[model samples]
Target: MQSVVPSPEGLAWAQRLVRLDTVSEHSNLELIETIADHLRTLGVPLRLTRDESGRKANLFATLGAPRPGGVILSGHTDTVPWDGQVWSEDPLSGSVHDGRLWGRGSADMKGFIGLVVARTRAWLEADLPLPLHYAFSYDEEVGCFGVRHLIADLKDAGIAPAACIVGEPTQMLPALAHKGVHRWRCCVKGRAAHSSLAPRAVNAIEAAARLVTVVADMGERWRREGPFQHGFDVPHSTAAVGVIAGGIADNIVPADCRFNYEFRELPGSDAQAMQAEVRAAAAALEPAMQAVDPATGFAFEPICSIPAFSADADEPAVRLARRLAGGGETTLVAFGTEAGLFQRAGISTVVCGPGSIAQAHQADEYVTLEQLARCEAFLDGLRRPAAAC
Candidate 1:
């Protein structure tokens, strides 16, 4: 396909958003409020669904008449931190160079958000057959927390969109399926003692290491076994421990150890079953631990969960997205997105947007002007009423 010049207003909006730092650890209210203020100027009615702290929020707005069966264009406001990444220029510069707009969220999602907002004027002026809704969420880079509140609020208000398009760096291609994300933290409690007397005292790090071995075994089993789904980069489900912390000194037996682990499972895989296996392994270890001390055992805490998503091939939303994206074959992704949550809420959904996932969360993250132009064309196509939608 030939490259097209991206909309000047859209590029400006993308740059404006990329300039703002809405890293996952920080509150995204500044970015949310910025977009809210712009929407207010367009006379669009919107609601702010704020988290309990009131520092972060999700913005849900309608561009046409207030009614059900609207089409939702969704994007997350928060981004992963660029702390350790080495970049030649400022990560938040939002600079336009080499036919690309560069910044922290230029590819991860803010590019799609900005372009969507830039098209508000045209969407507002057109006699749209159906409403166009904007659902900008926060904390997606962490675990897709903000969209839950937004969806609940929509339920309370009885606002149901006919379909949803999650702009999650799919390179302008519509995605039909993706893996689920489930994370947990395990804490082992033992009795501290001198390293020389470790035989009498329970060793937390050692016990935790045993459990970690079990986790690793389970992952290896899955890797070597069946239950694979084609199309995903890792067709089989995967498990891995990410963070671990324990002993302060090698001369002492540490009483506490904690580790975080996650499972990325296929759509039909039972994540709970996988978790149960780990819990059972922990239980088997508890007897040996309790023999040493009554207080010794394992505690599991859930960290985050995002369900797997698989859209029906004949669904109106899938058809609409593929058509808007210029009739490309639908694909599957290994990454998790809010698409599953939206689908669970009974809204036909697909993941489709500008940019490449490879550039997301990387140094000098960027979205090519050509990709943005293609996204703009896709959105323009969406503006025209179609029965498929």
Candidate 2:
């Protein structure tokens, strides 16, 4: 589907947003306050949840009477960083060019947040019975961190929304299923020796490489296995080492090496069991290494884990998205989102928003004006008195 430039109102709001840097590494308070100030004018009740470090926050605001079964308009406030990428202008340009709004977070989803906020003003005067809740979160690029805190606080307050819509970049399709993202860090400790005496020394990098091989083998095995869901492009689970660092000059046998790997598992597979298998592989290598030097072994540390998400195709959230967008088909996205966390909290949820995932995390990232128009229309539909919240 070709994308035309978005409407001026939505484009203006999105441009203002992208100018602010809310990269996961940086604080999202600036962007949160920007929205909060405008929301305050609407006279809605607001609940703000901050992380322990006080660097990020989640803003949950309600526009009508706070009653049971209100609908949630959810989008993350954080964005991935653009450090060394080449761009036609500033990373935060937010310029309208080539029939798209160009900026770092324009597609991954600051644009959707802007559109929802802009449409909210009109709804304030609507006589709809159900409340509309706006949920903006932080650190979503880094393992869905901030929303976890927000969910905990919600649990404490005993507040649960009737349903939720995660504005991930899925081109406004209702995404019903996605894989779990589980990551772990493995560190190898070995003895150091000169290159000439390498035969007597334990090689941490070599040992780490062996485990990398195991991870690749596991990924291949999954590709050939059963329990696959046909809708997903890659129907089976997947595993691979994403990052690794170790080794010194060739003259030295590395004494320490560490690598991080993750597996995106299908609903039927046990992620913990997959991790345990990798740990066992490391354990098998431990005995041989420790024999050379008692201190030479490996250690495993968990980094982060986000569970796979799935929902009934006929659920209210799915049906609402389909109805609002004039489509009932549900898609399975390749990337992860906070929908799983919302589902864990017992609020039915689905991922749907404007823009394509292909534009996310790349230089000159953009969302078409046409996509924003569709999203604004979708958000506007929620204001209908008869639309199921």
Candidate 3:
């Protein structure tokens, strides 16, 4: 297919945003303040909801008349880190080459955000029949963390917009459903002793290994079991231990070990129940460790929980997105997004945006010019009568 060139202003906006480094580990204040300044200059009323540390924030801005049935165009300001990845150009350069905008977040999201910000003037001049909002959040790559605070702020302000559109690199397609993500950190404590005196101490690493096996076994059971959703890429709920660390020397029985694990579950599945099952397994192994040392046991910490999201075919948010994108079939994605959180807050939500998820988080991530043009057209459709509630 021939690639359509995107609007120069939109391209410039995308490149400008992509140039900023808003990796999840780092603060997103620069990006947030930049967009805040632009919106403020345009006379848009906006609010900033900061995290507990006051280093990161979510930006919520409004345009047009203040009404109940307004629509929100949402995107995350942060991108995953590109450390240790080999790339042809600097990840933050935001270069335009070969009919695509290339950068760390060009596809994963900044492209959609940039285009939305570029449309602010157009939306303002149109005297929109219904209000339009911009919801740019932080730390989405790590989990849907920042958006939670944004939603809470909205609730406090008593603003109940009818619908939300989360732009998360859907190749310009609307996504109606996605899996949930629940993660945890587990720490095991035991007594350290010489290798020859190992029986006198509980082996923390060995205990953690047992827990890892239990998680793996559960994942395998889900893979072979009957509860399944056919459309998703990974058709069933899955679990795995991603990181683990323990021990100091070969001669010592490790006194402590830590590991991280997660579960990506289907829409109707009980993710908490799965977590409880793992906790039970850990509890079952605790008595043996406690017998060896009073301080030896297991500790678990909740990391992040992104709920599963699904929208009915006839939902207003889904209809609006499909109509603006020239009408395509809705999709189901394996990855998680803030749409679920929005839905939980009583806002009808759907995921749609420029680019493809396949290109996200890669060394040479890029969003095609064609996708940007399509996204711009979709945003322009908001000015039409059919889009009004």
Candidate 4:
């Protein structure tokens, strides 16, 4: 069968969006303005709300009536850092090569967002039966932060959606489930002393090392005996310390040390319980350190926490997604997305979009022309009237 193609205008919009540099650290104001301006030109009504820091913002727009329920097409506006990756092209400069678009956010998200926004315009032009809502958020790369406020606004306004589609690069398949993530930074403080009298000093790095070991052991136990029934490839919640820093030299007892740990919790896993186990282990180590120096202590602070989401394979949203994507079987993923937060807010949500997760957050990230074409067709199907029973 000959395949359908995306609208030329929509493709242009996607390329333009990919060109913007909205890395997680930088403000997404430029992207927001671009979206808002595009919506205005398309005659779609929009509202822009800035976070308190004024560093980021969220854009919400709707077509058709503000009814009790509608479909929300959502995507995050931030991209991960590309600081050290060796890329064939500039990560910020969206370049097209071999029928693929390469850039930082092209696959991880902006590609999906572009398709949705472009389709929204097509929907407006086509006068679809159901309302389509557009929701673009910032800081999703940092843990789904921007969408929280947008969800709150929707709730306060008594707005509800029949279903939500979070386009998080699912290779254009219907993703029914994904794991949650909890990130933390643990800091240990101890007394420093001369190398000649190391026994008199409480080494922060040493304390951090003990904590890391405890976390590793906990991960092993979880893998062996904890809840591991999920269908994911790993089939269990996993934990790891990604980064650690301490000590200036081998001779000196380090006064302060910090490490970042992350937990990928399987669906239904109690994230707090896992974190408590790690905290208890750190606490147990504190007294020994304080024995050498009374001021010694440890602290754990949240970096970010993104909850898990799963939709029943039989759910209407999943069924619709499968149908729209031409009947691929539903699947689960191990990575987290903003879909969980949407589900937590009582919205029936599913993850289905263009591009592959494997290509996300990598050097020369790109989405194939085939994925983009499939996604445009999916959106076109959504705009079609539901068939009568």
Q: Which candidate is the best by TM-score?
A: 1
> What CA RMSD would candidate 2 show?
1.8
What ranking of all candidate models by lDDT puts the best one first? 3, 1, 2, 4
Candidate 2 backbone collisions, by pair: 5-369, 6-369, 172-353
lDDT of 3 by residue, 1-389 (tens): 64487889999999999999999999999999999999999999999999989999999998988888789999999999988999999999999989899999999899999999999998899989789989999989888889999999999999888899999988888999999999999999989999899999999999999999999999999999937998899899999899999999999999999999999999999999999999999999999888888899889998999999999989989999999989877788888999999999998899999999999999999999999999999899999878975
| lDDT tens digits by residue: candidate 1, 1-389 | 66576889999999999999999889898899999999999899999999998889999999887766978999999999988889989999999999899999999898999999999999888877789899999999899999999999999999999999999998898999999999999999999999999988999999999999998998898889948999888889999999999998988999999999999989999999999999999999999899989999999999999999999888978988988898868788889999999999999999999999999989989999999999999998866877335
Over 4 Å off, model 3: 1-3
* Residue 21 displacement (Å), model 4: 0.5
What TM-score would each prediction reach against the true structure?
0.98, 0.97, 0.98, 0.96
lDDT of candidate 3?
0.92
Candidate 4, 28-84: lDDT as tens digits: 999999889878997888877788999899998888756666778899999999888
TM-score of 4: 0.96
C-alpha lDDT of residue 386 in model 1: 79
The count of residue-pair clashes in candidate 3 stands at 0
Per-candidate Cα lDDT values, in order, are: 0.92, 0.88, 0.92, 0.85
Give Cα distance to truth, residue 383, candidate 1, Å: 1.6
lDDT of 2 by residue, 1-389 (tens): 63355556777889889899999999999999988998888776789999989888999888887677878888998899888888878879888877788899999899999988877678888866688888899988989988888888777987778899999989988999899999999999999999789889999999999999999999998888756898888899999899999888989999999999999998667999999899899899888898899998888898888989999988888888889887766789988899999998999999999999999999989998889888888887888876756
Q: Which stretches of candidate 2 lie over 4 Å from their true place?
A: 1-7
Pitting candidate 1 against candidate 2, the one with the higher TM-score is: 1
